[model samples]
Target: MRPHTLALLLLLLATPAATRLASAACAGEKFPAGRAYAACEDLPKLGASLHWTYDAAKSSLSVAFVAAPAAAGGWVAWGLNPTGEGMAGAQALVALAGSGSGSAAPTVRTYNITGYVPLGNVSTPLDFPATDLAADAAAGGRIRVYGTLQLREGMRAVNQVWQVGASSTAGAPDKHAFQPDNLGAKSKLVLAGKSPAAASPSPAPAPHASGGGAASSKSPNAAAAAAGVAAPVALVLALVGFLATV
Candidate 1:
């Protein structure tokens, strides 16, 4: 066989196993010492994950939101939407790396998003009560936002929105990308019952400048299907690299 042909065959044979390993790594995620939760789920978008425990009696929720920013000095946010399912009307906790100063640690802040504007500038109160908000860097360059929220009475499930941005400005979260994964980042989070509940997609308001203000909803399957396409494209790129070398 030609050198490039042999390389292409090897890459094709390895792609499935590599994909499986990547999926398994997310599935078997482990928390740092002293950070434990009742359940966790690998979210379908943005390569994010959530570990949470809900207290039914106290109507409290403890959550650790985990995701990597799009680049260094970027930010990540995870939030709950009490009034709606999309980014608008959601209570978000944003994490940004701290500047290099004395005792300059990572920080997490709360943002009550009223619209699809830039999140860094909007620092308002959420609809519900939240406390113990903190952020820190984790292994693999991922940022973790840890907080406990006091939900309304009888809120068994919640609409969740998560995002990762390319950069932040002056300790504020910048706007995240509008890629398919970013747009499809919102989902339904079940607080109780069996673990790893199937995610239900929510209808987000049409993003600003995407024409006019309307409802733009994404199917859960569409995100999953788009995620699957990435692996094949990556394999093809690797094949092309091998061919160039040959």
Candidate 2:
């Protein structure tokens, strides 16, 4: 193949990887309905997945949880640790199958945690199922629950946990199925929109004499540096292509 053609082919082959890296770094990340955030899915022994996004301007935090439906019909609970610790002092949202006219829809209740007990009736009608959860129920299955909550001052960071339980009937006694039970293992909820630190300008390198001998072409450092430079160039090219398509 002609040298120019070979170079063009190599550039084209690098474009996809570059585009993915660029998107991951700078594009707005979205949490898909009914799925765990990719960053939290790998937590050890995690049975349920939670995803959250915070809108600082609106002072709101939207959270979603996804877990397999209990075979015998039960409840799924997500809790927040105001102190960033254990189940104690946690605020939980519990979703259970409803009864009577709203039986088809799941009902959500809020509780303030103390030890193993859920105290107080903080349950409000604000919590509801996501569209995917509704669709799943319509198709004879249930898998997801989502809702938005007002973020109080200094609530930007907190510990979070999930639990699943078996309940014979709606509002019946619940049998715990899964709970992390360890504050150390609980996941964290971090709000978005924090400003990143500005980078200090790097000093320009001293210029070498033009008549000096060229550096060794086979040097490992030289090759590595060249590879690093090429990667960003490829990313820029891929980003340009993506913007053009948009």
The lDDT leader among the candidates is 1
lDDT of 1 by residue, 37-131 (tens): 54556788998988665666677777779899898778899999978889999998888876665135567888888997765654678777777
lDDT of each: 0.70, 0.47
| Model 2 per-residue lDDT tens digits across residues 151-181 | 5655556677666655634364365644434
Model 1 accuracy (lDDT, Cα): 0.70
Evaluated at residue 173, the lDDT of candidate 1 is 79
Q: Looking at candidate 1, what is the lDDT of residue 222? A: 33
Over 4 Å off in model 1, which ranges? 1-27, 101-104, 198-246
TM accuracy, model 1: 0.67
Clashing pairs in 1: none
The worst-scoring run of ten residues by lDDT in candidate 2 lies at 195-204
Off by over 4 Å in 2: 1-44, 98-103, 118-142, 168-170, 178-185, 193-246
